[model samples]
Target: MEKVVRHRGWQWLVGVWCMLAGHMACAQARTELLHRAQENLTRVIVHDIFSPPVASRIYLYANAAAYETLVLGDSRYVSLHNQANMFPKIDQPAAASHINYELAALYAFLRTGGKLVFSEPMLKDSSEHILAGVGEVDEVIYQNSLRLGEMVSDSILAWSSRDNYAATRKKRRYAYSKEKGKWTPTPPGYIDAVEPYWSQIRPVALDSAAQFKPVPPPAFNTDAASDFMKEVKEVYDVTRKLSKEEILIASFWDCNPFYLNTQGHLNFATKKLSPGGHWMSIAGQATQRAGKSWIETSKVYLLTSIALFDGFISCWDEKYRSQMIRPETVINAYMDEKWRPLLQTPPFPEYTSGHSVISTAAALVLERELGEGFVFDDRTEMPYGLPMRRFASFTAAAEEAAISRLYGGIHYRSAIVNGQKQGRGIGNQVIQKIRLNAGIGK
Candidate 1:
């Protein structure tokens, strides 16, 4: 009787050990899967110089697909297929077979990311290698998960086809405006304006691009004493007197993918994140810092991406509508001929700053998702060889990002201030419309 009792006790200990090991493995998988998504996104950003609006659209669709697929395995989150204006139909899994959701998420990212990015072979091979690591222990479950991921990707791509992204690509040419106070390509390449038709793209949350138009910027005035000229003077004078800290702030938020290198004639350009990519990295960092699970992290990315997508649309509507001049153009025309902005002015109309709008919009969603007063060290820009700056909260970082445009001498005060207000409106709409739940949607 004593021998039999000891044998049963040993079996119980072995079962508990297996359970603990399985739990640990699951946690590690979640962490790795999230990190993998962030890395691939950075890859696409660095692949070429995508304009801010185009980059936002890419981020939105990829993340939306990943979020939709991930939430299918867990009911704690909701899908945005029908909630967002025109997302396509995604079929639910046919069977209740056990799925490793982490594997499914990585697979979903692979499918959507491959379709959106230029680095298709690299992304596809990366996914296959990752899936291989899951082992052949459960081949049937693995195959089903991959199929589900592909199904989600196919639906997302179908929806993306109607967003006017490809149509805009055929008409990429934009006419230059030589009129005073109008945008002119500045410094560096001096290429024609980027994405002049961006506002025409379909918005994820906004009813239309003009749904949340910001007030027009102050009218251009050539007189030295006029308010418009005064604002231009402010940009010129502030740039002239920029402190070291101010310079760092401007450099930190530059987000110009093809900023001039100036190191050599052969290598005169360096690639970095666009404004949208910068905010996406911030969202990923915030989600990780909050110790969120993969399911919860997907929500953060989805919300932030959608906010940025619509924010860009609203910002671009005001940008082209106002056709207001950039500080670069104003300062050179009316203030000082020799003056150059502390940063390179991107080739586009400047009313309603893009950086300010997207950054604040992303901050709003992040704050709502992660709560206020969250502090974290930002290493997202570190890979670009910039120093990591710590922030007290998401708003603090966004406010700095908004003001950085001023310090960079790229935008006037009105554009920066008004952009934040416009962004907040869009962010609120995303929150009000999207629903979250722990049950499957109809």
Candidate 2:
């Protein structure tokens, strides 16, 4: 009887040990939870019609909140408080708290994102849906995890509040100058320039907004043989006789947030993912392919968002400084009175393509994270009805993105080329600046 009792007791102890081991693995295995929360944030950003620049801001803060939570809760990861210098020191939970870092990271992302968007109730509904799907958990661990999440998100929110976004809102709107070759609102919607003062916002890693400034745009001359006119003619000619392949490529890369469709006086607005949102989705997809743990995935999003956050600041500085005109506006006025490009031009200056700049920056950072020559199928456009496109490498995808701006007729070749140069510099700078996940980016 004593031997039989000892055998049963040993079995019970082994069972409990297995359950504990599984619980720890579950913490790392449920990275999908974080991705789902990020997807929800993207949905809200689309619903809100956030411009690309503003969408980039929302992405960085939400992702930073999640990333910072992991750094605080997980000892495997190093804290970026002093490394990045953007995040301030945050209070942590008690040392022995049985916290679930995965749940906490999701909550941090949701809470920070909810504060940035207008529709809190929508985010609230998604939050409940996400939380309901989590696996069974002890009530004590659940409460402790959520408390830590709030503490981390609150610290991120405090740091973001002083980036000068509010002060720019109080400033007057951008006024279009009557000078020749200056940018103005484009047709189809004729919306005013989006985020003209975005350069004034604080940068995350860059020393200043103009840290990666490109050379001045081609001289604006109307003479038929002039460099500017030659560039202008190329756009008019290429768009006029676009191939089926060109159309598909242009449509695939058109990450316009809000586009107006008009038909005989019945006009409505259509919403799509912003440029930054597309890259964020790609990172999520790639990480899943690599089977990265939650800690690795968190760092990827944080670093990619940092590149995009600073890329926009650098690009916008040159944009408003040069104030070069868009292709559609110039082609219609000088080349052909009724000439419209194959794609609708976005409402912004054309000195540096935002798509080109941010895309290259994102791709460079992704290469550093995922590595060079990493091939993957890009399904980011599938949600918008486009087919999957395969890439041999991150650089290949980035080059395609830069050329897409020209094919879309939204950018001069100079803008796309220079934007790539600028983006490359920003990407290298970001990789050099961030310290966590060492021996990886280097």
Candidate 3:
């Protein structure tokens, strides 16, 4: 009788140990899965050469799909199916049975990411590897996860079809302006403006693209003593005296998709992350540091993506509307005919900086989710051969990115300063208006 009792006690201990080990494995898998998803997104963005606005749209829908699907599995979280704009009616998972939340979230993330990115084969292979790592579970649980992921992906894709992405893709040509205060292509290529019709694309959170336009850029003045010329001179003067640290900051946040590298006769293009992509990487880093669960990480990506999408819309609306000239253009025309900006100016209208608007919008959402004054090492640019940058807070990083444009001589101080304000407003709107439930009961 004593031997039998001891044997039973040993069996109980073994079972408990297995359960704990399984839980730990799932936690590790969740972080690995999210990290892989983000990497695939970067790959697709670089290979496909998606401009910033199009990249933001892809991130928004894909992250939202993943978030809505994952939240369904966690009783501690609620779905955003009906809460967001133009959300499709998706089939809900079975509420009666015990579902494996980890597998469900992983499968959903894979499905959503596969749809949004161009590197389909790589993403699919990564998903299969993740599923294998999940090891053996009940066949019903596995099948259910697969089915639910497919449903969520289809729903999100259907809704995205109506967002005018296809229509905008057809608009390849834009009118060129010779007006002194208006934008014209700059340096290298000096090609037609990129995504001139981007403002017409549907915004996820904003009422319209023009919902919050920044104040008009100060009137174009050629007079060297005028405020407008002073703004141009500031950019010129700053470029002349850029410190080594300032140059590093400028290069760190360049985020120019069309950067060209030419040495002698060997010219090749360097593919880098867009502004929105950089913020997405930051979201992934913050979530990993916080030890967030799949549901929590999904929320971070979803909100940050939406902020980028809407922030770009608002910024571009002001850009094309105001038709403001870049500092490089103004400086060359009036100050020094031979002068060029320290950094290559991107081919787009300037008013509110795109980097400023999106970075601050994403920073605010991240701060809200990951505590105020949270510090982290941003290694996102390291893979691009840039050194890691440490930030006291997400806001600090955003502010620095805003100022880097000034130091780079690509934007005036007014555009950088006002762009931060516009971004903060957009971020506040996202935090207050878009409701996500912490618990599933609601």
Choose the strongest candidate by TM-score.
2
Among all windows of 10 consecutive residues in model 2, the one with the lowest summed lDDT is 1-10
lDDT by residue for model 2 (1-442), tens = 0001121343344435547878555544467778888889999999999998999999999999998888776676676676564668876679436887777888888999999998878987888656544555567777777888888889889889989898989989789989999999998999998899999999888889998999999988999999998999988888888888889889888988888999998889889999899899889988988888888898999988998999999999999999999999888888798887777899889989888899899999999989898898989889889999998988888888888888888899999999999999999888888867634443
Report every candidate's CA lDDT: 0.79, 0.85, 0.79
Please write out the lDDT profile of model 1 over residues 337-401, one tens digit for every residue: 88888888887888999999988888988888898798978877888888999999999999999
State in Å the error of residue 389, model 1.
0.8
- Candidate 1 similarity to native, TM-score: 0.91
Is 1 or 3 the stronger prediction by TM-score? 1
How should the candidates be ordered by TM-score, best one leading? 2, 1, 3
Instruction: Evaluate candidate 2 by giving its C-alpha RMSD to the native, one decimal.
Output: 6.3
What is the Cα root-mean-square deviation between model 3 and the actual structure? 6.2
Top of the candidates by lDDT: 2
Estimate, for each residue in 147-250, the C-alpha lDDT of model 3 and write its tens digit. Answer: 77667777778888888878988986888777768888887667678788888888877777877777777788888788888888889989998899999999
Q: Give the TM-score of candidate 3.
A: 0.90
Report how far off residue 439 is in candidate 3 (Å): 7.0
If both were scored by TM-score, which would come out higher, candidate 1 or candidate 2? Answer: 2
Better of 2 and 3 by TM-score: 2
